[model samples]
Target: MTTDRQISDQRVALVTGGTSGIGLAIAQRLRDDGLRVAVLDLDREEARAVANDAAFLFVGADLSRRADCRAAVDAVTGAFGRLDVLVNNAGFQHIDPIVDFPEDTWDAMLHVMLTAPFLLSKYAWAHLAASGQGRIVNVASIHAQVASPFKSAYISAKHGLIGLTRTQALEGADAGLTANAICPAYVRTPLVTRQIADQARTRGISEADVEQQVMLEPAAIKRLLDPVDVAALASYVVSPAAWGMTGAVLDLDLGWTAR
Candidate 1:
């Protein structure tokens, strides 16, 4: 779906984790589409570049902290005077068996992926409604729909994030606000590259085997998704054509969930 108003003039988007990987690709795509962009990331160097060079405002901070999340929202609102789109994309994965998972890491993952989205949305709620085109696209994973072993915390958080997306969509529908989740099976990125190595070690498999057997084996595509594929879906979700959509989970999981 699309909208009549050009994305550039409607309002602003605040994207957490916009410095790299899928986040960076989304930020660049939105900027190219003419929307004002504000990025929240922990990378100081990249933040400086984006702040100075891109069609975006950059705030360098750790999003796992509620205060930091609020600060990033403040920066977005401060820059654009209103927020039209909020993309909750900051996430990391730690692969460890449930019996061996570190307590602190588990806490951090839940806070960053799940809690941060809730806090950012709450902080940006009024501005979104006011925009009359409020949109939220959560970056969930295929694991949100199904699970694998040794990913209890990450899987749980993604599942809960989808639930949050549904609830927000229901509550915001009457007010012209829409919320949805994008679930991608596997996208090639630094994080997934790391996961490959870690999975190899954990499963006593070679990296090639992990890629073939564990990751791509489940997909009909048999190749990692392009970051742009996910970004395009996200851009559409927040557009005016998407006004009627809410409480939806859009999955681009390479048919993994088809099974």
Candidate 2:
């Protein structure tokens, strides 16, 4: 348990899309690490649920909207008084071939996955820098490095996210802040669960086949990654131990990238 003194001394973290799955896990991990935690999600009812059940503050916002992104950051800083760690983990996936992918869906994906991170980082920059030990951790995908079929919008947005992460790291180098991205493969979260179902439908395969042939085909490790596994990496990225690492991409892809 973090004491009041520890909470006061530790940095506050605001996690976007944090009401459930990987984002929620990351929020819990950081909260357990003694930081004051706030979660931003689009669902107001879900936000209330997280606040009540997890004891973390929750703010409602749609990451696809720039105004909502800015409002989320303002709400967190207002509630916590300072924002020091940012984990840009809000994302959704729409699996469709380039020829059939919807234009609006593509726009939404880019806005949420790429633009929202940039806007959040921009809004949070001054407070993070003022903290004198700011850390930004972006939860990118293995797709960030390697492309996959039928995920045009998702792949493009993730690749762009890594670019944004690098830019943030370079710009913050002299400002007592660091930025990095974590690229993971097939984590067991709602997003991946949805992807599994989508892949099954798209490829005319069973969900089990989606897991075995589609999701695990690239990774040496056959099992899906647990949420805590990714959360542990996020925790490390924002911790003092990672102070020297910036503009780096930490791969937790079960050796998928090594190939």
Q: Residue-pair clashes per candidate, as listed?
A: 2, 0
Pairs that clash in candidate 1:
2-241, 8-34
Cα TM-score of candidate 2: 0.94
Q: Write the per-residue lDDT of candidate 2 for residues 1-259, one digit (tens) a residue.
A: 8576766687899988888888999999998998889988886775778776999888888888889988898998888789999999898888778999999999999999999999999999999898888999999989999997888999999999999999999999888799999998888987779878987998999999999887898889898999999999999889988889999989999989887
lDDT of 1 by residue, 52-165 (tens): 677568888787788888888888887667898999999998778999999999999999999999999999999898889999989999999999998988999999999999
Give all TM-scores, in the order shown: 0.92, 0.94
Q: Residue 210, candidate 1: how far off, in angstroms?
A: 2.5
Q: How accurate is candidate 1 locally (lDDT)?
A: 0.88
The 0-to-1 C-alpha lDDT of every candidate, in the order given, reads 0.88, 0.90
TM-score of 1: 0.92
Q: Ten residues in a row with the worst lDDT in model 1?
A: 1-10
Q: Which parts of model 2 have CA positions greater than 4 angstroms off? A: 1-6, 198-206
Backbone clash tally (model 1): 2
Assess candidate 2 and give its lDDT.
0.90
Name the 10 consecutive residues with the lowest summed lDDT in model 2. Answer: 1-10
Candidate 2 steric clashes: 0
- Candidate 1: where are CA atoms >4 Å away? 1-8, 198-206
